[model samples]
Target: MMIRSALAGLALALTFLMTAAPVSAQTVRVGIVIPQSGQFKLLGDHVRQAFEVWNAGNPGVFSDVVEGDDGCTEQSGKDAAAAMAEAGVDIVVGFLCTETLAAALPLLTAEGIPVMTLTVRADIIAEEAARLGWKFFRLAPRAGSEADIAADAIFRLWADQPFALIEDGAISGRELVEAIRIQLENRGLKPTFVDNYRPGQATQPSLMRRLKSAGVSRVFVGGERADLAVIAYEADYQSVPLKFMGGDALNAPEGENPIPEGTIAVLAAAATSGPEDQAARDAFAGHGLIAEGLRIPAYAAAEIIGAAATRMTYGETSLQDLLGQTTFSTALGPVTFEPDGERREPGFVLAILEDGSFRRLSIEDTAALAGDSN
Candidate 1:
């Protein structure tokens, strides 16, 4: 009877171990939602590669990747969200389009899944996330941040100087310039002149003439890179000696007119080549990939998820709670999210375009540069 009882206890212990093996060894499933079949495929491919690079370094975490075709459309977004929920993904990442994110949020929210969007930076979505209680995290800069940063930088550098505010219709230029104008005005600062300019013109000589007439030495133009290029060129052509500043739109591809040297803009630091990005850049180079555009942020998103997942597994905190409260180190430097899921650190910087590239400058540097330009 004693021998039989001991054998029975051993058998029960074996049964328990077998039952828990699969549960303990289960790997995380990460849902990648991006446009796999559309005009944005190239961009999506970049994001996908970043995840692959990240996974190569950390093998056990998120061994399975559920690819979702966002298609950059509303219906596809819904389909992707549903599929991810059905597949039981631990978290979702790589949403580049506003349409895709807007459609997926409600469904993912219902499923209690957290999402870290690499793009889709419209301010409305952030506000909606807070209002609707969606577990959404934004890794990209907010849409109106350009205006806010520009206003603050301009106020610091050119508050006492004669400066004008101008914008075009391209890329929501009106809204950005107006926001900057209002912010500066609220700070008790007013522009010397303000007007709307027609974009895509071959020559902005007339605009330059008007700016010259205003007796303003500095101008902040909320317009496209191409338009700003022309305006700056025309200013140089007319010998106006006017120093030009712009919002983040200046970071876009150069137009027929090369962006003039010494042009200042408020923009984010380059995702690659910084001290913080060295490891990521080396990893990308090893895999024959270049870190550009949406790739670095996507990589950072994966790291955030992996770290949070590990912490959640070892602690009593939920992934959502951990993400909201903890500051994670990434290739973009230290990233912290507000409870609403907006990234708080690594804000926009003041940069000067020189010899065809933008070099970030300090506020003190910007002040000195602005004074010299005038």
Candidate 2:
């Protein structure tokens, strides 16, 4: 009788072990770095939300997230990287700002942790990440794409109409406006008026008067949304026919139309909502979050990372090979990045704000553009 009892106990223990074994491997470990607090917290929140949305419907088991808040600062970024490195996570994702990402690179690379960044910094591939041979990937298009997208839209709308370019005294603003200038010059048209606007000052009366007096009908703005809004408002207040065109920075202008009703924009957003996106958008709305901008890009990045993670778990491939060789089907569409981490597809879009939302204008086919991409 004692012998029989011993055998039964062993059977029960084996059954328990079998059940718990699969459960223990269900959640993969991953480290997430984002600005959970500070100036960029809203964008960070959207990143987290996008990951959660992707996790809900993806085929992988799940990931146990170890979060690090970079707060869009260099010190915070290092601290966040140190925390994640200490956690012994297999991979690190996020780092949505240049300041934080730049600071954290050495730390992450020292530990041989793969990083998938959501921020668009061209210098990463061209200079730092490439030189170091670090396993870092940028999931967004290069900043230069904003210029190409904006120029394409402007060329379509006013190839004949003389336009003016204005910028604030910021590096990003200068780059944006200079892109417009280069594109215009390439097409044999020089801007009639080129000037700079003060970023935060409430009054642009003198600047507005100058543009109007110059008889400029269209103005391309490369500055803060609030500043452009003030300019647009002043133009309307004085009955000036100046219309503003710009990149996605214009989307942040609060309250109402910051530019004229027919103003055009080159949006950074790659994903346009479709039937497949309804569930995610609805889920986001249910939680009082808007799934836009960084959200969609984050979702696409998570999809790529999740798929690679799953394969890595199965020992089928490594993250480096998967990232370099594969094309991911994202909510935006099929995406493949060049060796230099530039996205190898049509990455920019043109849209006009209508009835409080961006209504995209039909342009060249993305597939054709991708085919012709250098």
Candidate 3:
């Protein structure tokens, strides 16, 4: 009885709560499986707002949608996908967190729903998808993409400085640091120190001491921003003039700007740009969800799905095959996935925190370095 009632609730929600009026014929039933609640609730709001913009386009080929919140938790992720499957969605998208999509994959596979998740777990599409014979597409950068861009930016900004690499001992962090280290070594340059430290420790003065002893003036950190900030504080106490840099984790919310000014980070998602960008942001804000961070990517996801819907041949067209065959034009420009379902175009830019805000560092005309531009 409980399960039946739950299905009825989900069905009603999908049928009515989706939009104010009934969608026209040939509407695509999309299941948006993202965290609508939990620690990642803000990301949920951004995605919802972006989807609403996509929904506003007339007879927008996508509808009958159901939403599920994994709260960035595993069990919730599986349950959410299962619930959406029961609600009769044809496709699933928007798994922002890694664990969320991973937990939901088996259920989605069993239901024969193809998922195009918005995450950076390249291994899923790179290895697991083929191994398990599950159709999963990743709309974000592969894990290695982060390191690739970071290395390029580092070389552009401080090619001659003595540098160090640090990680938090987590798989993600370790992989990121090692990727950069290898790329640097390939260029015949090596980092001054490669260090791994436990996360959430009270202090890391000892690590700071070691780095200072090595005459390391530039750092590439592959872990939590809080830890980076802690490193900055300890460096200051040790009177070591150093610049701290890292991947996307540098901008992660950690209560406040823990790292000192001039610290840099590389992020995959860029800010919305131009008139089209403003229109999306306006539409996103109009929906009551504050737009930021992941909003552009969310909008890009909507555009990709909507474009794919245009090519769907109701009875005969295979969605999974079409996805691999077509190129999607997104807010981030044209997006085409590699065979492993990773985005084909990958790059990173340098951004430094200045005056309480992060700004892009243009290395185009950098006069402080060698002419390594290609």
Strongest candidate by lDDT: 1
lDDT tens digits, residues 1-374, model 3? 12245587787776665565533335578888777656777777777767777688635577666787766768877888888889888788777877777788778988888888765455554577767867677777677778888887777666777889999999889999999989988987788889998788767888988898889888888898888888888888889988878888776665443677877788765532434355566666676654576677778777777777777765766677767788876666667876666678773445767675666664543443235222
RMSD (CA, angstroms), candidate 1: 5.5
lDDT of 1 by residue, 273-348 (tens): 4677788888899999888887788888888878876666433567788889899988877889997888886356
**lDDT-best of 2 and 3:** 3
Total clashes in model 2, counting residue pairs 3 or more apart in sequence or in different chains: 0
lDDT of 2 by residue, 1-374 (tens): 02234588797777777766633223456788887777888878888888787777664545577888867788987998899889987778888878878788788889877778877456545367777766677777667778877776666566556678899989989988898789868987688889998888766898988998888888889987778778888888888877677777776736443455656677765534554356557666766778786887777777777766555544455666777788887665677866655567656667666665665655443333223321
Error of 2 at 52 (Å): 2.5
Residue 340 lDDT in candidate 1: 85
User: Residue 310's C-alpha lDDT in candidate 1?
Assistant: 69
> If ranked by TM-score, best first, what sequence of candidates would result?
1, 2, 3
| Residue 117 in candidate 3, Cα distance off native in Å | 1.1
Which 10-residue span in candidate 2 carries the lowest summed lDDT? Answer: 365-374
Misplaced by over 4 Å in model 1 are 1-27, 270-272, 370-374
